[model samples]
Target: MPDLRLDTTDLERAATGLDAVARALAGTDTLAGDGAGDLGHDGAAAALRRFAESSTRRRDELGRAVEEFAGHLRECVSTFDGTERSLAEGLGGAA
Candidate 1:
């Protein structure tokens, strides 16, 4: 039961982290564009490239965290199902 709670907490934290990363990426997008067409070509290019790299790394980290959390959720579900089946079988129902 405690383990389940911990897993849930971890999942929540991971989700929050992803949300922060998404917001950061959005902010970067706003900076990457030059609304007045006054951006120096080289500087704009460098800024865009840097933003892209940072966004990519953040996205990858989020993806991995989500995948790990999903795996834990799957395991928990399977365990719960097995326990339910066992209980049903003990109660004389086909588990």
Candidate 2:
């Protein structure tokens, strides 16, 4: 059988990385800028505004999803750590 090791530390690190990514996404401002209207052509400016709106929405959704996943990972790490400690204590008590 292959040795399989599960590391909660690695999971925590990954969760932290995800958190950073979520923060970065959430910090993003509009790509079109506030002066989108000054683009000269109304049609082109309108298109830019639409694209910026859509991108912002998608970025927010993705940020939320990433943060949620990171929370789940942290939960898993906590659960696994508790389980391991419990199991170790049980074994020690038995010995």
Best by TM-score: 2
Q: Clashes in each model (backbone N, CA, C under 3 Å)?
A: 0, 0
Give the alpha carbon lDDT tens digit for every residue of 1-95 in model 2. 99657898999999999999999999989957566798999888888888889999999999999999999999999988887788788888521
Model 1's C-alpha root-mean-square deviation from the true structure amounts to: 6.2
Error of 1 at 70 (Å): 2.0
- Lowest lDDT sum, 10 consecutive residues, model 2, at 86-95
Candidates' C-alpha lDDT:
0.61, 0.90
Off by over 4 Å in 2: 1-4, 93-95
Give Cα distance to truth, residue 57, candidate 1, Å.
0.3
lDDT score of model 2? 0.90
